[model samples]
Target chain A: MKVMRETIVSTARELFRSKGYAGASMNDLADAVGLKKSSLYVRFPNKEALVPAVLDLTLQETFGQRDSASGQWDDEFVEVIEFIATTLTDRGRCVGLHLAYGTSDETPIAKHAVRAFFQAHRDHLSSILSRAMPVDVARDIATDTLARLEGATAFVAIFGEKDAMKRAVRLSIEEAKNAAAAKSLSSR
Target chain B: MKVMRETIVSTARELFRSKGYAGASMNDLADAVGLKKSSLYVRFPNKEALVPAVLDLTLQETFGQRDSASGQWDDEFVEVIEFIATTLTDRGRCVGLHLAYGTSDETPIAKHAVRAFFQAHRDHLSSILSRAMPVDVARDIATDTLARLEGATAFVAIFGEKDAMKRAVRLSIEEAKNAAAAKSLSSR
Candidate 1:
């Protein structure tokens, strides 16, 4: 049952990514999931309830693997960004981010979900960056890093150029390193 | 007549920003523009056609003013980003870019419209940055700058924090300046 629920959420997430909340239909989700619309509703109640479930699953499935590695912080940082880029290029799994940005002004649920996700992601990134720089500076770099990566992901989605996002991520990492170096130099 | 068309497009753009393309109904647009749905179609045939027209008007209205001022490239560059951040925070006037990212995958019209906007913006930015650095480096910075600004715009939309976007823009401009300085030093 757990596996079945995960499958349903993952499939819904994919549909949401490509078709958007307003564009994606529950009937299609039912068709894709190999269930009748009635059965799907038995599991999810309605589209409104289903979206948050899908987002939670996305958080777990997409970012859950972020903590498994034991490499150096720099390697981990790059790997984390690479994972996000890979997701954006591979399946446009960042659809929740898109929905959040698109309709959060009118939808409190989406606003909360996306804001929590971004804040959590920023906090995780800041913790890693703080090891090499001041906490305040690290927090700023983390915010900047998330903004660049997220923006690059959107650009790739719009333009279909993988390299554009890759270059942006690389430059952001480089800039953060440079800022850290400059901060250290000034301190000395 | 031309002024009326511009007013309609600008008003539709605002509706699209706060509401996603799928979420922004034709009725809502009609109401926002103080026109009946039938009259709105007389102007735009359909919502699909209306979006691209709105995007073109947005390009002319937003980025059109980019070249009117004669100032140092650095100041102009920062000013452009500030302008963008201002738009995102001020009135949420960046709905076209949002549409491009959100619907471009399934809609060819959206893909083309957004691609053209991003490409043209990058080219314009490249022209400005080229004055300060090598063309190749300037182009890279231009792309990076666009990605950052676009991403920061989305960030502000999602999180509703104006300062986060503002700080990201400032940092990106600073990093670009530093990159130019480093390139010059290497050449010297």
Candidate 2:
């Protein structure tokens, strides 16, 4: 069923995020979900085929975690702050981005999937930032803010200092509000 | 000689930065400097050792690349903007941070070189940011700005577009300058 496929992909994604692509084995993935590697092949032709699916799940999980929370919560400040915290606070996600971002798409194996996953996210972020500022500038802020979160999260993961990461999130909120305040003032 | 080791590390760092950690193989590293991988290993025990040393080269090169055209070079704004640009604009330097930040010291194989590499920079950033801002707040801005640069650069790397990357860089410059301006107004 489609639900089972989703579960399988999600499990594989957790494994990949914890372990680097080169470090993660198919057998390990099979063992995690109680399904044989053979059974997985029906859903995923190979580990290579499964990688993109897993990455998609990871990105979706990341987005959903924020989108779901941000949807009901009407506070713009909390929405942006929590969205950043969710992305940066996790050890697994930080390491995962480094592994994923640093890879090249020279092989069909890595290319299209990487393109799809990031472009979709960028488009989504563009939407969020656009609400706060002009289209191009908002998109730029979204890209810049996301980049800071990604790199800073990696540092926090290694350093294990939530304070540093927290400081960063606060700084972002201030910048957004400050910029907005400055804009409102200029207009007035 | 120390000079030879420096040359090897510098060349390898540039290659690794542009080509990426995995994509830049030992053989290609050798080819870059017209040396054999074996000869290269004389200065560097292996990739593990080379990465740290290469990262040092990257930091040095980054600081060195800062324009010294003006005697006003030490101004906090100038220093931070250029430093942010080096980390954000260049794919290799971003990878240097990626590799360093993602690397764990749980094993002896894990190099702790990031401390020396990032500390001076972080400290330098804070020291400069504090010049015209609150100490605690300046520290936050420093981390936020650095993290933003890292994040924005990664986005550019993934998307590989000129306008987006350029806009991110421009915003980054503006954002830092704005923060400094905000800090100045608060002090007054």
Candidate 3:
């Protein structure tokens, strides 16, 4: 039963990514899961309930560990950008990020999920940035970097174009590498 | 009647900024405007219609001029950052930018408005940045700069705190200035 529920949620996450929260109907969800509509309701009372479940799953999958412990901030920055590009480019990912800002005024669930996502992202980026710069500067740089990524994500989500955003991501990675290199030179 | 319609749109813009499109009810809008809800509908068929009108007004007021004829790219960059800071921090602004990303999946109207907004913004910034660097480089810098600003705006919109985003704006301005100065030095 637990495995079935997990399967349902993972599938629903994909639906939400491709079709969006409002676009993905319960009927579609049930059809994807091969479950009767009534059985789907027995699990999730409404679409809203299903949405946060999908959010949780995406967050878990996308934000695991840095994994590239090359001990180089520049290398990690590039890896992080690569991860972001993959997630943003995937048609069926970052649904939570979309809905968090998209439906924030109307839905507490969305607002809560988005808030948690930003906080977690902020903390993670700040910690990573602190390795090369002062804590305060790192915090600012982290905020700036994440803002660029999210901005690019939002741009693609709105317009379905990746070229401009991809260019922005590349420019950001270059800037981070330069900053790190400059810091090392100054210290030397 | 036209004046009244304009007044309603401007007021609705404020409500949307403070409360978000989903949060601002017709009653709240009517109460703010000193009119009955029925009369409000006479001007705007529904809330969705009202939102785009507000977006038009904001774009007009905020982006009317690049007036920094001083021919200094650094001055213009600071002015642009200042403009963004004012727009994001204003108690009743940037609602369209937020809603564009937030309602993009569900509403074609939102998607259209956001796409136009981003395209216009990119054109405007690229034009300004071209004064400092080659056209291609200017376009990339413009894209990166706007993404950073939008991301910071989204961060503040979600978290209800402006400090991190504000810091990002400051840092971005400094970077732009330094970049422009470096380019000028190379050309010299």
Candidate 4:
């Protein structure tokens, strides 16, 4: 029964990633899971109830072990971009982006969950950059870098332009390196 | 009759912007426009057909005369960021982004329309940057800048942090200025 619940949540995550919050109906979830509507309701009660579980699974899968042991800021930053690029180029679109755009005025729970996820992502990036620059500069660069990444993911998702995503990643890493270099020079 | 048709398209655009592509059903649009489902179908034939008209209206409203006669690249760039920032912060979310993310694999027409809109937006930004720097550098910067704008807009839309959007715009403009200055120095 526990395994079944896990499977259901993971499947629902995929559905949400592909169809978005509003687009993914409970009936669709039931159909995807090969369960009767009543059985699906028995498990999740309602669509909104499943959001936390789905988000928990997403947080685990995407953001697990993000810290780098090597402590190389540039390498860490590139890894972040590569992870985003892979998600965008691959079949699975950015789940957070889809949820961010798909959650309407009606779904406050989903909205809050999505917001928390993005905030955490931004904070993580900021922490990674802080190792190389001042806290404020790192925060700003992290915010800007995350925005560029999210934007590039949107472009890739919308346009199916993998090359554009690649270019954005390359440019983002180069910009980070330049910023770091400039900071070092100023300090010297 | 034509005015009513235009009104329906505009209202549908709003619906699409808010509810998303898949989330906005024909019944909902019919109700929003105060028309029967049959009547709505009489005009659009189907939801897919509405994608083009909806996108056409969006293109006209958002991208119209994006070209600046002032010929000052920095001001024009800031204008672009301001436009995006305003859209994200305002009640009306970025329609293109909603369409881009809300569109599922089933909705090819919606997908194409979204792709075209983003491509045109990128091209316009690139053209603006091209005037002040090397074509390749300008193109890269334009792409990066657009990605940042889109990402920042997403952040504002999801998190409702207007200040972050403002900071992103300020940073983007400063970066553009720095890039322009660097180009002038290199050329000399």
lDDT of each: 0.74, 0.61, 0.69, 0.76
* Candidate 1 residue pairs in backbone clash: none
Models sorted by TM-score, best on top: 1, 4, 3, 2
User: Residue-wise lDDT of candidate 1 within A96-127, one digit each (tens)?
Assistant: 56667454545666657767767877887787
Q: Which candidate, 1 or 4, has the higher DockQ?
A: 4
lDDT, model 2, position A164: 59
Those runs of model 4 whose alpha carbons end farther than 4 Å from true positions after fitting are A1-3, A66-74, A171-188, B1-3, B66-70, B174-188
Query: Per-residue CA lDDT of candidate 2, range A1-188, in tens?
Result: 22388888777766655554544578998888887778888877777777687767767665665653355222554475576476658643553464455455544675567667766666676666555656775555555555656757755654555665665566556655565566568867
Which ten contiguous residues of candidate 4 chain B have the minimum total lDDT?
B62-71
Candidate 2 residue pairs that clash: A147-B151, A147-B152, A148-B147, A148-B151, B17-B92
- What is the CAPRI rating of model 4's predicted complex? medium
Q: What DockQ, on C-alphas, does every prediction get? A: 0.56, 0.36, 0.39, 0.62
The candidates, ranked best first by lDDT, are 4, 1, 3, 2
Model 1 per-residue lDDT tens digits across residues B39-100: 88777777877678878887786678666438898898888777767877776436856576
Candidate 4 structure quality by residue, lDDT tens digits, A107-143: 8888788888877777877877787878888777777
Q: What is the interface RMSD of candidate 1, in Å?
A: 2.0
lDDT of 3 by residue, A116-135 (tens): 77677667666766687667
Candidate 3 lDDT tens digits, B68-88: 456776677667767876778
Candidate 3 off by > 4 Å: A1-3, A11-38, A45-52, A65-74, A92-94, A102-110, A131-134, A182-188, B1-3, B14-38, B45-48, B65-73, B102-110, B182-188
lDDT of 2: 0.61
Comparing 1 and 3 on DockQ, the stronger one: 1
